[model samples]
Target: MGKPMVLFLCTGNSARSQMAEAFLRQHAGNKYDAHSAGLNPQGVHPLTIQVMKETGIDISGHQSKSLNQYLGKTSPKWVIFGCEKAEESCPHVWPFSLQSESWNLEDPVDFTGDELEQLMKFRFVRDQIEARILDWITENRIDSETEN
Candidate 1:
């Protein structure tokens, strides 16, 4: 059988959800198939690529996808909303029978600051997602070979 799937959702497929997807894949790619999508698909943010690169994970090839894409497809093992908007707006009856949860992370794109400050915010958000992924891996005993 193929690896179990984990889906991350957010307002835009640009930041938080993207970061979480990348972090999970890097840490537990061998154990789970990580994917991400948005309520309103906005392309992946450039800062996301930069911040992920800092952690040695390249999300540059990741694309913005809408939640509808997975509507009639395979059900993920876990569907995690990375932002409140996604959690609240998600459909009551999804096609999948997966477990769902919310992360309630602040949107880094909503941060208003200078270039350097904005970059720092992105990095902070990226680190936060990575930390959460690591915690989840340990708690679930994923047996990930990647070093955090």
Candidate 2:
């Protein structure tokens, strides 16, 4: 059997959800299978790749996916909504026996600013997602000693 799966959901698979997926995979790849998708699928944002690369985790190859792809498939152990839009829009009754939670993160892509300011916003959100994933791993006791 493989590690249990955890899916992160968001309005767009471009930033927050993608960051969560990468961070979780980096921190606990041996304990959980991290996946992410959006309700309205949009391609992964360039800023997402740039910010993640700064942290030494390259997400350049990651692709945005839709929630529909997993509808009839094996259910994930945990379904985490990375933003309010996803949590509010998601079905109230999930088909799988899974735990769900909302993180209510701001969308970095929605920010309006200069190039440097925009990059900073992306970095901030990226760091927050990484911290949250690390916290989740520790709180869940999901084998924190795993290597990348």
TM-score of each: 0.91, 0.92
lDDT of 2 by residue, 1-148 (tens): 5677888999989999999999998988878899999999889999999999999999999999998887768678788998888888875636673688889899999999999999999999988888899889888774323312
lDDT of 2: 0.86
lDDT of 1 by residue, 1-148 (tens): 5777788999989999999998888888878889999999999999999989988988788999999888778678788889888888874535464577778988989999999999999988888888999888787664323312
Error of 1 at 9 (Å): 0.3
C-alpha lDDT score of every prediction, in listed order: 0.84, 0.86
Q: Which residue pairs show backbone clashes in model 1?
A: none
Best prediction by TM-score: 2
Each prediction's RMSD over C-alphas, in Å, is 3.6, 3.0
- Choose the strongest candidate by lDDT: 2
